[model samples]
Target: MQAFLQQLPALIGVVIGALASFAATSAAERSRWRRTQSVRWDERRLTAYAEYASAVKKVISLSVRIAAHRGIHPDIDALPPEEGLPALAAAEEERTVKWETVLLLGTGSTVVAARAWHESAFRLQRIASGREVELSWSEAIDAVSKARRRFYEAAKADIGIALGDVPESYDWQISRLIAADSTPPERNT
Candidate 1:
């Protein structure tokens, strides 16, 4: 009886040690699971952001082409209204479909930014279609560009990226202009 009583403290210490180890392991596993889930969701949100941006850009591009037809962009080759309108409609439809995914996966700020971008893009479309003449092409383009920058900023922040500010780049437009100017005119034989 004395021997058993003396050994009781040792047995109790073993049980406590085992319980502590179990608790620590459980907590670590739970933390790991939570981290993995967070990463997976972040990846999904990033993909949604990218796809939505691509869709919106397609709509904007078509609108720009249509606007060029109306002599809004002197540097760009004009796409006739008959050809531009149908393609614009198709691009807008794709943007709408991509918007649903953004709504589902994006954070609040990101979703708001996405909405702003699309709304601006819609305004650009209206300008191209001659539905809204109050806003000039350059004004519409600036609005869309600003909204796009905001959306990208929100998306980057949501995904834990630390990009300070997205710089405004109109290099593509400048390059296009330069290329157009450099092209040699074809001579009639």
Candidate 2:
């Protein structure tokens, strides 16, 4: 009986050690779970941002093509405005659906940037639709460029990406439009 009593302290120490070990393991698991969740949300946000950007670009590209066809852009090779109308309608429809997803998944700043970009795109669309306001290629392209820069900045900030990651010459699409509009299209046999 005396020996058992003497061993009670050892038993209590063992129990306390087991409890501490369990607590430590539980805390580690919780931390790991939180980290996983954070990574998942980050991936989701990136996908959402990228998809929204792509969709917006599609609409802008179609608008550019339509404008070029209407002789609003300097491109001589573009298909006529009538030929691009169906594709433009399709792109607009896709943009509407993708914008809904952006609204659901985007942060506040992202949404704001997206709205600005979309508005800028709509300006080009209005010009393509023959608003008769004499919108110039430079003016339309400039607005889209500014809005796109804002969106890229907002998206990068949201994802913890440094602003420096964006290249200085970022408007590849707009540049392509300008260059295409300036040059005459090759004749097809």
Top of the candidates by lDDT: 1
> Could you give candidate 2's per-residue lDDT for residues 14-58 as a string of tens digits?
999999999999999999999999888889989888888898888
Question: Backbone collision count in every prediction?
Answer: 0, 1
lDDT of 2 at 59: 81
Off by over 4 Å in 2: 1-5, 132-137, 165-167, 172-189
What is every candidate's alpha-carbon RMSD to the true fold?
Answer: 5.0, 4.1
RMSD of 2: 4.1
lDDT of 2 at 91: 84
Please give the CA lDDT of all the candidate structures: 0.81, 0.80
TM-score of each: 0.86, 0.80
lDDT, candidate 1, equals 0.81
